[model samples]
Target: MRVFISGYYGFGNLGDEMLLDALRALLIEYGFRRDELVVLSASPKETEREHALSSFKRGNLLRLFAEIKRGDLLISGPGGLFQDSTGPWSPAFYASHAFLALLKGAKVLIYGQSLGPIKRRVNLLLVRFLLSKASLVVLRDESMSDMVPRNKLLFTPDPAFILSVGEVSGLRDGIGIVFRRWKWDLESLLRVLVKMGFPLTLISFQAEREREDGIRLSKMYGLPFLTPSNWAEALRVLSTFKLVIGMRLHSLIMSAMTFTPFIGISYDPKVRSLCELLKMPFLESPRETFAFSGYIRDIMIKWDRKSEGLKCEVEILREKVRSVFTRSLNLLLGREA
Candidate 1:
């Protein structure tokens, strides 16, 4: 059966790309051939080249409708695509895709997504209607459990948890910082971290805005910058770090995957939710009054214990997440879940 995968792909965002990567990998492991997989991407050429799968431009509605009309299923995300915080367009856009798939008699799997902080009544109603019609709706966290029917809702960790990384030769005894363009007081945080005397590296998770931000931060702080070309490379690089202070959700996710302790700087609810779910320390946004030094000091004092605990938690989470995907895929394909 042909499966059409859709998400925020081809936008140079490593997190979304990692979601696609993990989803594709899991689907393959679950017995789907590469030829049966199709992706809807903003840069279809790049997506096709990178993923070795069939693809078509995301904006081509005629093509999308035609594909769903003939395809067996449509996977609508493993990302936060249903929220209106970014604007109503995002919810409308993703919901419309699922709506089309259902309209054309194709099954819809709302894969590993984080549901809304969708404020607008119209957007929320439309999203709920589309979700109600989906064949399966998997949420990444329990925060929005109320949004989906209990029978339809399955909780799994982010799909990126299933990503595999290779080993790196040289491991570093330093902290890595993953930053993006946010209003947080980064310079002050850097000052506090520098006083702790460990080496610091600026790691970039995205190819565009985040890379530029990393470069600027590296120069400003006289630190080295590293930008991994893909999610595996990012995981390998993160594995070498003793700790990570990250603003990006996937950065912290990779840190956990690598068994590296991380401090999450919550700029969004998704980040905060992940941190809370993992029982990790996270500083809230607009953290001007947050006790940076005290927080770091406490984490450092408990570093070994925390790291060990995180390793155990991640392993358990990995198994549960893998099983969730396997079961969901099995059910979707008419097998026992």
Candidate 2:
């Protein structure tokens, strides 16, 4: 069957790419052809690099409509798709885009996704309308479920659970710290980690970087700052890093999938969910506690203890993928429930 995916993909952000990665693999395993999978990405480069199937710019409405019309199934695969983390109308990006496919008469399935505590009335109504059109929907958290309609599509872990294949390594002496907005403190983190002899590779995922936010932090702790053009390269770079400290969900998710001893820096409820899945502990960014080096030292010790567990987690993840592919495929093909 021809399938199309729409979400915050195409950005070199690891979390977003992992979802796309996981969803595509599941469909293909269930017998979809590589040529049959399509994605709406922010840019074409991502489609070429990380995405194996056809890809397009998410902003191109006419193209999006055309792809959906051609697809047998349209999936808003995983991540916090329905939330407004970026803006008041952000839910529309996922909902409306997925809705376009539904309007085209595609079987719309929203799997491993999230609903939100809508900050606005319009967002809530928009969510209701968009979700009402879905053939299947699974909100990742219970609190989010109440805000969304009861389609019996209540919950699943983020698609990262299904996407993480494994960690590859070629670390080149420098570690990277990738973050989204409102997640890190630049100066204090630099001083503490660098003094402890940590090498540097600073990264950010905000579409626009605000130098002002990290003024004191960057100047005192001079580090190489960069951003990946999209996730395909990010994964390549991740393969080169010794470790990662990340605030965005995808960055951290990618690091874990690679088995890097990552320090997840967000306490957002969604973030907490991903961490729990891995049985990993995370810090609340720069403010969560003091004696930063000591905290990290302790976590490092625990990571060594739990490293074997990560291998086991990978096996469990693979099993879960087999089940989801079996179930979703059977339903899509009108087999027994």
Best by lDDT: 1
Q: How much is 287 displaced in model 1, in angstroms?
A: 3.0
Please give the lDDT score for candidate 1.
0.83
Residue range 31-136, candidate 1, lDDT tens digits: 8899999998999999988888899988787897876764489999989888887676898888777888888988999998888878899988888887778899
lDDT scores in order: 0.83, 0.67
How well does model 2 score by local distance difference test?
0.67
Q: Number of the top candidate by TM-score? A: 1
Write candidate 2's Cα lDDT for 1-337 as tens digits: 6787777776555566667777887777777889988787887775756666788787888887866664378878677767665588788877777778777878888787756646778887888877776777765556466645564454555556565443465444556777556735545666667767867777765545544444434565776666666555566666566667777777766666566656677547766666677777677667654655675676555755554566577567657656765676577668845
TM-score, cand. 2 vs. native: 0.80
lDDT of 1 at 139: 90
